[model samples]
Target: MTTQTQTAVIDQLSKHRTVRFFKDEPVSDDVVHTILNAARQSPTSSNRQTYSIMVVRNPETKKKLAVLAGNQKHVETCPVFFAFCADLSRLDVACEMHGEKHVKGLESTLVSTVDAALVGMSVNTAVESLGMGAVMIGGMRNHPKQVAELLGFPNGVYVVFGMCIGWPEWDKVPNVKPRLDESVIIHHEQYNTSSPVPQIEAYNQTMADYYGKERNLHESAWSGPLANQLKSPRRENLRSELESLGFVFK
Candidate 1:
């Protein structure tokens, strides 16, 4: 008997790559509507649907956003930029409509954030399936408050992350990035508590081969740079800033 081939969705997911450069082309409103409609079907927690997307197309706004995102030019150049926000403001109003008090706590924060992430992933998948390219910008959290003010966001809403989508400049596109091996990331049934050092070392060499040809880097690709980055706190003020935006951690 012949083995069945993997599904189309699996094939598409396996070839995922981050496209940081894009061609000077526009994504039409019809396409945006179609993608959003599909992405809105992504599952949400308790049907709360506690997320919002800020679709930015204006060059001036994109320019400011690019600066706020640590000079990520893709934010400015991509035909469309999506700021996926964890939004509790709608829920706050819903509570008020029923004469109930809206509670702000860690549970709500996590739900909204996760909801935003799920929708963003859906959007990315849809974009790629349609032959466009995209990249997620995590630097949106770098200056959360400033981003909020710039985008005129109400209280109880903050950008969880941003996405850039457009026709890719194929010539400038890089190879698919390698991920940690399944042995390191996946466990059978229960969590595996063994040392992952061996797997990591092997993956590092694999990355070295890939990066050496692409980026001319021969250093340990996985662990060494990660260790240096984790040595110091990143976005140390993120907690305080999110608190100021009405998110509760307790």
Candidate 2:
């Protein structure tokens, strides 16, 4: 690619932000097709492509999903919503077609989940490149059973997450949030976990300032909320839920 093209790509990536507010407009079918095509090009585990994307456009369905997804308004308001599923059902059929027995367990679940995540990120990047905006809604997992039933998902299929896509309300678009310093996350060859406290402190202050100024919320540090979250079990029923959906993460 030319330097200009590379720079354009970098600029587009750097400007990514979660857009909660959207314009009262619909995305063109051509654009949707292009975005999904990009997602299809993403790499998958063992070339199995163990994932599925469901596009939801009906208002009533969106409303119901919004409620299920912790009442996120973007789920209801976005012109398009995608439910990305980690699906093993297709793999089962493929194995049967080839006269091979399908054996699914922890490894299979991990592969499918990774495949779904990779495609989801690819779709997000594609949306951003097209000057559209999106937000991933992990809250969809909060009530996986209900979400699955609502979408008529069969056993061996489950929603990994949802994405809301639309033309962002430019005036209300948020700035790109800060991430942890690379030093804290990236290690040189050997693993280095000597101490990340300082890095965490710095990042927390940076995030606190950003939230206070940009989001009009007061927070002393990011670690506090994260620590609080770790103090208790979250989604304790996820294991049973996954088992019910034909996943044996053993």
In candidate 1, residue 133 scores what lDDT?
Answer: 95
What RMSD does each model have against the real structure?
A: 1.6, 1.9
Scored by TM-score, the top model is: 1
Q: Give the residue spans of candidate 1 off by over 4 A.
A: 1-5
Q: Assess candidate 2 and give its lDDT.
A: 0.90
Highest lDDT against the true fold, candidate? 1
lDDT at position 240, candidate 1: 95
At residue 219, give the lDDT of candidate 2.
Answer: 77
Please give, for residues 82-200, the per-residue lDDT of candidate 2 as tens digits: 99999999888888999997899999999999999999999999999888899999988888888889999888998999999999998898689888999978999998978999999
lDDT of each: 0.94, 0.90
> Please, what is the TM-score per model?
0.97, 0.94
